[model samples]
Target: MQSDNPEDQKSTEGMVDYNRNSAAQQQIIDSQAMQIRGLVEKVSNIGTEFRIVDYGCGPGISTINVMRPAIEACRSAHPGEKIAACHADQPGNDWNTLFGLVSGPSGYLNGTENVRTEAAIGSFYKQMAAENSVSLGTCFAASHWFSRALHLYAPNTVWFADLEGEARAEMAAFARQDWLTFLRCRALELHPGGYLLVSTLGSVPDAQEKNGFAASGRGIYRALQVVAREMADEGLINGEILDNFVFSLWFMSEDEARDPLKQDPELSKAFEIDTLKVEPAPLHQADLFADSIGDPVEYARLYTGYVRAFADSTLRKQLFEPSTNSAEDADRLADEFFHRLDGLYRKFLDKYAFEIWHLTVVLRRR
Candidate 1:
């Protein structure tokens, strides 16, 4: 179900679509595998039962692939130490898909006779785990999502990655609050020597100077706006409704990502920052298709499908339903909107380069 609260949009946006484009996600997960294993081992050395929480686990792809293996390896080394792994997310998450993945023969829990895995569904902003319980907490490509959408301003745009002035400030404030809440919750849940590793979507340095989506190739979001306007002009959707549609996703910069932890003396005193770095994100579309790369038309289909899976629900909510416009009619119009968007992306692909920014941080609970 779609949420009246825009924050749930993160869950409602579709994780299955994200799982389909698992190449880039898997790349990042694999890159961090060694670090995760080290942390798990460090906790296991305490000679106590260990717990791992994959917060906002999505479809559990990363948990099953990267985290489960790391935890299981730690369990094996510790012999009889109990290792419990929890996949946490909002209840609206696609739990069926997650269950299917974790229950199959190839599932993370399948071969690990000594490890136990369970689903813990809830917002991480609250106490998802018992106080001072979790040994290692891993939240990848998930913390950028705020607890609630900043409702102060709605621009004629979809993502906060391309806003300025008061709009940007409002989003920054929300991100800061969300970040603090995230840290506080984790601090309370983590044992004295536990570790917390977080990853998020980010922008390049001086991102604000060139607009927040500087690394994303400005044309990507512009194409979305153009298609929306054209759909309104064609009587497919309400002009007012289309004009009001805005996505709640906010990609904080490196400084913004760190400010909350640095400024809060209490938070800073509780957790020691181990490492914070911004790096180039893996561009799966470009990397995977490099050898067999085709013309703009073919690439557009692949790109749009990847984007559509995540963005279509956000757009669908704004579609008006009048007597003349049934849900079926709206669906058809939505399809047309994406079709035109694909064409626009194809036309602009050659003129601009695609780039993505990523941020990774490691913290130790004091």
Candidate 2:
């Protein structure tokens, strides 16, 4: 299900270390650890073996940060039970970096017994696990990505939030299809009564046009598009390519997320919603960074690194022809873009405020 499109270029270069930069992600994952552990414990009580899949586990940090703790909790609850944890993501992910952490002396899963760790490389939209074989599934901040491109060009915009007319409609369809496809796939992979916990970037309630996580006093995605246009104007990239480039990402509101289940009873019947909540944006990272760093330029650099980590290489592909541009040139242009962006971020540092929302959902198979 992997496509050789611009969107498939999700490499983890220039990415901020998740443990350090992603305070928001860490907070969400940490808040849910006890619940995840309880689910693992429930599965352990029913059988001698338990399996958990960290779907779309980028760089395997979630495996170490979230899943490893849950597995250990299960072990403590059921002394003799066996547990296996699998980290699933696209094949192009930084598995080397992930495994390096796994093999470290103080590895996340170090000193664990009867717990096997594995790497599963593939699309979560497809059947990554055996049918009815998985006891628990966890996909955080990943399912919003579509399995394919939106199939239409986004005019002067990179995210669906800014698109209008047919472009907006096409992206809405894409989001609906991708969300349902993900649910169906997980439905098949999970055993009866197994649990699936998903947390994703969401939109502010009733804030129709403000659907992106903004940084530096403006939408980070909007800033990216602005820089892209400037790159085209300076002849650093082709104008047509810049106009046609889109990020192929969508953030749904709380109500929009519930629409799929409302429309499809058969799909809805497969699982029960344990919790569906939209948390107003958290400013933990903002406060922490301001207190710790206390410098605009360095703070901006850290923010840029965090954003670039998730969006690296994908946007870089638009700047030059694959046939003509050397990898070195593309990388250089990518770095240049971030350099300019970091300066703009410094200028807007005092005006920073978080506007992003998160959809925390929990589902259990029937």
Candidate 3:
């Protein structure tokens, strides 16, 4: 069910059609969205017209639904400056589905601004936003790609490199630079009294031995690699399946959360973080699905859509690699996963809990 409050638009990243398998993730997204909106509402320009821009807007469903209240409130309070919603996301993002949101009767925006996300560079954004075009900027859950400075989906060069550290450094540089770049771009876009709000999946590590996905922080991906490799050895799947998928995560101990900006000195130097709060909320497992279940496999399928979706992707990749056919075979695989999931539930009921780092950091444009 969509949220009753329209302000939910500010935190709509996780609502993408990417097949969230884990029901647990929805709560996290909802919690983080609320935090982001709460922080955004506190921005000094409450009375000012908002040129709202959703940085890294995913499907736009969540954003459109969540930001509704803000739009209506602003419309009620001051209608002089129209509400302009600028949605900036990656190049191949599903725009038809994303922008199609505007056709809805209760769309959260009065205007739509869509910009292809640059892999690392931020100059185009600066130019697209123009000088001082935005009154408010919002990004949620998507900043981690830049925060960790990971590789792009497709970089023009396709060159090979053997140095892992150099690659990591490059990724980090890209992340930090792009983060600062958006902040700069938004800063220039916002009027003197404008504000910017950003919220991403965050974590402050603790010694409590909480669950971090399973197997490893990269449990699903690493497990997929293992499963894929095994299937490949058995001549059941393609060896190149690995390149088609990528997943990454980051963790900062609670101490690190004390000053969230410390992770990126360059970004900190460029953008001043006015408010950074790291709050650990209990995983409301029941809130994830329409109804809760004790079985872990059912839990994964219903409660952990985010993780379950990834696992399903890997399984589908294995079945479809090189050759594709057999609707019956696909059905069989689905049945097998659910059946095995039942067994796995009996295997690790106590350790199945997923602990995510809920991070909230707001940066003012420099």
Candidate 1 lDDT, 1-366, residue by residue in tens: 224655544434454376775554566687787788777766633435678888988885776875666666676656677778789988777888888888787787776676777888788878899888888888877776667534444446655666667876777777788888999999998998888988765666664554634533334566677777676788776766554455555666677777878899879988888888777765543233333235777767766775676566656654433213467875787678789877876776633233456678889988
Best by TM-score: 2
Q: Rank the candidates by lDDT, best first.
A: 2, 1, 3
> What digit string (tens of lDDT, one per residue) describes model 3 on residues 1-366?
122232221212223245234233334455555544554454444333466666666554655543554454445444454565566665445566655665555554345333122121122234446566555666655554422213222121111111134543454345445555555556566555455666554544334423322111223333334444454466544334433323332333333333325555654554566777555545642122323346555655542345444344324432332223565665554455445444443454434344444555556655
Determine the C-alpha RMSD for candidate 3 after optimal superposition of all C-alphas: 9.6
TM-score of every model versus the real structure: 0.87, 0.87, 0.61
Query: What residue runs in model 3 are displaced by over 4 Å at the alpha carbon?
Result: 1-16, 19-29, 32-49, 76-79, 109-128, 146-185, 207-270, 282-291, 303-305, 308-352
Error of 1 at 136 (Å): 1.2
* Alpha carbon deviation, residue 173, candidate 3 (Å): 5.8
Give the number of the best model, judged by lDDT. 2
Instruction: For each candidate in the order shown, give its overall lDDT on alpha carbons.
Output: 0.69, 0.70, 0.45
* Candidate 2 segments exceeding 4 Å error: 1-21, 42-48, 207-218, 281-294, 319-324, 350-354
User: Which ten contiguous residues of candidate 2 have the minimum total lDDT?
Assistant: 209-218
